[model samples]
Target chain A: MGPLIPYDIIPFEWSSIIAIIIGLCFGFILEASGFSSSRKLAGVFYGYDFAVFKVFFTAAIVSLIGLLYMDYLGHIDISMLYIHPTYLWGAIIGGAIMGIGFIAGGFCPGTSLSAVAIGKIDAIINVLGIMVGVFIFSELYPLFEPIYNGYFYGNITLEDSLGINPYWFVFILTIVAIIMFAVTDMIRKRVKKVFY
Target chain B: MVNRKLVKFLSLRYKILAFIFIVLAGGLVLLPKHEKQEGISPEKLLANTINPERYISTDALAEKMINQDPSLLLIDVRNESDYKKYTLTNAINIPLKNILDEESEPYLNQDAYDVILFSNDHFHADQAWILCTRLGYKNLHVLNGGINSWYNTIINPKMPTEDMAHTEFELYAFRKAASMYFGVAYPEKVKKATVIKPVTKPSITAAPKKVIVKKKKKKLPIEGGC
Candidate 1:
């Protein structure tokens, strides 16, 4: 009911304002929880500290729970949100590349931007790398057109592809994440800390 | 002074929290459903095209024509020659070529009419609908199956190509080599819809510009339907 944009229920103008507010909240939360550090973000690969794991898992779980609650409570419709298309080959290849990039640069796009806000030099380099990568992708789009357009399942959401209710999926995913969170906390205690 | 006020505010924290909770609950009650409303429903239609109101069934439009709803405006967004030949009854010819050409503003400005547009296919109608709607025209609608559906439902009413048209068997086809050379689709059992209307041919003032649009609307030779 409450998707402010696209419906034109709320004026199209509120979209940018909402995005800015959401981004600010997101940035503030990440910065508050010490996600601005690259070494901190990189610890998922190195097994030094699992603060990243705890924080990320908690946030994901929180959002999932919140979305489910919102859907149930009828503040927002779950069916309306844009689901990330499952490009099987693209998701596999692109995710692998992003995982590698995450480990190497120690910052994903969101964290990199937040870090840049605070004048972190390494994050600036990481952000530049991301920009260059995006530029290269755009320029080379013609060459990659075959791959990009090869297998389209037509904007299918996870529910459409998997034949499951989104609420149930979110609930199950929440359970799994909670388990993973508990398991990682144990693992984090075991890994010897290297203070950055 | 500020510390005492701050303490008082802190002491009244439950009241503020209760206020927020009540506001959220009130909003949940007040905000309208995003899906049920019209306008392509940019979010949930993408989310679920099965959403009935958001879906513009071309088959349904053909049915509406057969039933003769005079209020429905069918816009032919194909070029002039394509439009001049065999547009449906009461359908307006606003070709895609001159759609944005400023002179065609009256057709685009028909917000009162439930305008369903089409061409050789849905591509042109969809473009027109998208263009008009994106420019803030709410009444402009898409003819989903386009003229192909006009052929299927109004012309012949056959089984669909995708999954065997769920409707009952009402027609068959002439698979002969002679039919192919002529480029006639839905050849048999398809009569001009307006032909049955006993044409004393009173200068059709019902038509806007004295254009004899139905002249090219003739049926081919006999066969069953598909």
Candidate 2:
């Protein structure tokens, strides 16, 4: 049942139903984990709390390991998965914009939707702000088209780009993540609590 | 001194996570490294050729020629005698053994042309395809069922049976037009001897071991906004 869509085990007609179920689960999990709290989300930047960093990093690493293990065991064909193509300069610029937005808004796109479900007026405003940003980008698409489309990198994987063995890269990343977790805890203890 | 106290009070969850990471890292280190396979393997190349999309039907080839599709390039992989006796219009003869020769390199490797290789049946065309795939050639396709199929389908087309589908009749009509365009005189009504079997009909056909028939589905809407 793993990678059900790609294997065509789940028919194409079931995609929308599957999507809604997945979205519901995601929103439930996020809300249950206290991610809907803007203060808790923003605490990562200020080093007041490290829950966001710890949870996200753990989730990423766990999924990475799980997928690698599944692929190694031949349960799923990883090559058949659609990888989002990379555009070098476009990625850098887009990431920079996103980072700034994340820090200022205190609610990511997903979390903001969760927040809105709880009737938070601020979350509604945040969602509207995101919509406005999207509208502006679409309107001015021609102007930004060159930058958006430049530096095509053909959906290259991290291992391909860095020229390192995948397992070695995973090992290195796990070590780095552990170090970051330990460091973030230290910073959180040192910083004065904001109690928000 | 403070860091030592914090370490002493480290939570059980953190300890377990740290253990998992360390174990995974150690396991990764111990695993034997194997070089990744770079290009298409012979088995995979053969398997890919089983896909019908890799074959341009003889009728389609005739239609393309009729329309003067500049991108289409036909290569006859039979001997010079067979090629001279009868070959598709504007086809170049490059014998199966000579496919890798220096003179044939440019004809085989161009991106602009949809290079179609053919033989009497699919045998030599498949061999040519295998050679091309192994050597990392792009845009090379086998003419399905090859020249024999070409003659049966285009040089003389058969009218559809009484109970046949409308689409089959439409295809027969198109094949008739193609036959006429290629200057091959075909009968209005096909005799039992002249009637050709469907392309996938097994007795005379050197068919693949497995043929996966993919069902057609309506195109789904583009998914994901964020």
True contacts kept of each: 0.00, 0.57
Residue range with the least summed lDDT across 10 consecutive positions in model 1 chain B: B215-224
CAPRI category for model 1: incorrect
> Clashes in model 2: which pairs?
none
**TM-scores, each model vs. reference:** 0.49, 0.63
Candidate 1 clash figure, as a count: 3
Question: Compared with the true structure, what per-residue lDDT tens digits does model 2 show for residues B143-195?
Answer: 99998999888887776654666667668768888887888653322322233
Which consecutive 10 residues in model 2 chain B have the weakest lDDT in total?
B214-223
Q: TM-score winner among the candidates?
A: 2
Candidate 2, residue A155: lDDT: 85
Q: For this target, which candidate reaches the highest DockQ against the unseen true structure?
A: 2
Q: How far is candidate 1 from the true structure (C-alpha RMSD, Å)?
A: 18.3
Writing each residue's lDDT as its tens digit, candidate 2 over A99-159 gives: 8988898998999999999888888999999999999999999999998999999989997
Report DockQ per prediction, comma-separated: 0.02, 0.39
Q: List the residue pairs that clash in candidate 1.
A: B160-B165, B171-B225, B172-B225
Tell me how far the alpha carbon of residue A46 in candidate 1 is from the true structure, in angstroms, after superposition. 1.8
